[model samples]
Target: MSLLPDSAVTSAPGLRRAQLLLARQALEAILAAQRPADAILQDLFRDNRQCGSRDRARISELVYGVLRDLRRLQAIAGVQADAGALCALRLLDQGLADAATLEAWGLTASTALARRLAGFDPATLTPAQRDNLPQACHERLVAQYGEDATAALAQALRGQAQVDLRVNRLKATREAARQRLAQEGVKAEPTPRSPLGLRLSARAPLQNLASFREGWVEPQDEGSQLIALLVGARPGDTVVDYCAGAGGKTLALAAQMQDRGELLACDISAARLKKLRPRLQRAGVNSVVGLALPDETALAKFAGRCDAVLVDAPCSATGTWRRNPELRLREPDFAALQALQLRILGDAARLPRAGGRLVYATCSLMAVENDEVVRAFLEQHPEYVREDAGEILRAAGADWQEPELRLLPQRHGTDGFYAVAFRRQGE
Candidate 1:
């Protein structure tokens, strides 16, 4: 397809045609390589420098909407739909496309295409098959968006996700941040249970907002904000943020300490820590002492000195599928995550002093990463005991949960997260 110049698509008719064409091309690339939807959209923006920001945003929304609801759309279309074909089907489903849209995209709503699609009975396909095709075809479909077969797919496809932000308490209160954003023509409502969270009804480009630029707010999920609250860093106490990648929660911890306590923020990646530097400055956080740990020797320096240790271990990020549905495409493999969690939990446990609290957190919905990891760690170290996270939050005047702080998109309107807290034996 020939790339059209922005000026050529200045008219309404021309813009709609360009959007359809771009959506088709982006879907084809996704199907061809199994690229993540976000990555595909980014590549589309990069490749089509002529496309304006509005055009890119519109195309991305349409593409992702179709990907999110491909299964249901295929059911409605009643055919074995490929990725490129799914884009057309979605346009039809949304009433965004008519006979003209297909033709404009250089596609003939051909009899042959219809016949091929009509041949397969979407009803006949097994639920799993409908959600995620066989492994052989999985890659192709995933390349085309076939991996979204989970039971939660329907929910994810039906709704538009809201923007969540955590108020930077170090810079401003949630009410103050809300007021600041309101003056800038953005609407925000406080999130329940998270003292520092605000939910945006409409998604706005936050970086352009004066409130965001002035460090009054930080883009963070409500569940993530709660995770930091669970850490409960107190003034004069020493805390450690193990696996503090880019220090999102680390800064929150610093804020909770009122910038009075010492916070040792440790991460394996120096590159990620470097990124946190600017954020620290923006949040006016000074209590955090950044530490790059290349190996265990680095972790050894501050062993048994921390009062509270937060191990936000890495996982498959199953919890964040609402924000990035592409993660559902990832193969459900616990082996690598299990190994990494073991190392992180072990290292994190060593960092806390006797009687210190250890909070293990993951943006993962899996049992293996949340409950099982904690169970295993407790078994190995008899001196540690699981604390009731829900009770702890309640005692802190925040309403949350223990057993499982699992936040499902359908249930909590937040990312799926699993957090558990533990306390060591008294000195």
Candidate 2:
């Protein structure tokens, strides 16, 4: 495993050892700096541009795998162990390396990690350890989904997320998009619940595909696509995507409108809203107008005028844990987040005209952020009435049939999302 040129072991196992060490170093930086794993990885790749594609992918997989199960790895590696021991423990537990191979790699240096993980019985570990969930998360899961379903949801989130794309029908139909992806060396199939959604067989370099660059496809989770569908924006109607960060749903709504309606994409961050212009242009979305928020006059103009309003409120983002495993390490301020969610709901709830629909959506699995917020908002604003979510899904041609829509990673193979639609009644 010598890295020095004079004693360099160029064998595959030696290279593998070197790579794992590097990954562990990066993981240490991620935890120490408290930075997003994806951002840190991007920076690492950017600085070491000489690394091949395979090397980058392998490194990313190793890093994310460890991050996903950091809690379990830590419990096994002991509180005294460093990041290197944690990585070693994860690789061994995953059976990525045999004891003999690990010994050659650095077993002496990682004795504590190896001893702890080897002696540790996975079944004896608590649910938090077995499922790599925070101990705090278990109680909340029970409160949200009861005991049985909570375990199921936790296990589902422990798996990797599927790569999903939204077919921009403005440029190509779902069938055409599927065919185009196939021709580009990427195999894809239509998502069962989203007519315009395509699930890739494996994650591929999307930017390299012609369909993506040509605006025929945009990478999006099926759950997110469903949230846009819940909005039910239509042609000749004015729609508002309040809090549309970078306007992913805004683009979808424009396509649903056949690019024939007024669609305002608003966000508090000007920097994020600025990104929407290029995406809108690329998607051939002609009906979207991006607006930075806190502009009293701007928001007032759309008040009580939109046929549809989508409040894609911010939350803990626990639903996206599969894709962003780093978030699993942080604790959420539930009280502050819920208060903010209610304020945003109240603000966005004003845009829907009488008889018009306002959809509240969150990429969160927590009931406090989804149902509780909706209930509070409904109580405050009696002018709005909740709509049948399953009825809307059926009308949108989705095969789903539940009174409420809660797409989970394990259940639906999509990012966890909770959406409830309501039509503002005339007072």
Clashing pairs in 2: none
The TM-score measured for candidate 1 stands at: 0.85
Expressed as tens digits, the lDDT of each residue in 177-275 for candidate 1 is 899889888999988878788999788898899888777888888888888888878988899898899798998888889889789888888888889
Candidate 2 stretches greater than 4 Å from native? 1-18, 98-108
Clashing pairs in 1: 31-143, 34-143, 131-149, 141-146
**What overall lDDT, based on C-alpha atoms, would model 2 receive against the true structure?**
0.83
Per-model root-mean-square deviation over C-alphas: 5.1, 2.7
Tell me the TM-score of model 2: 0.93
lDDT of each: 0.73, 0.83
TM-scores for all candidates: the values are: 0.85, 0.93
Worst 10 residues of 1 by lDDT: 132-141
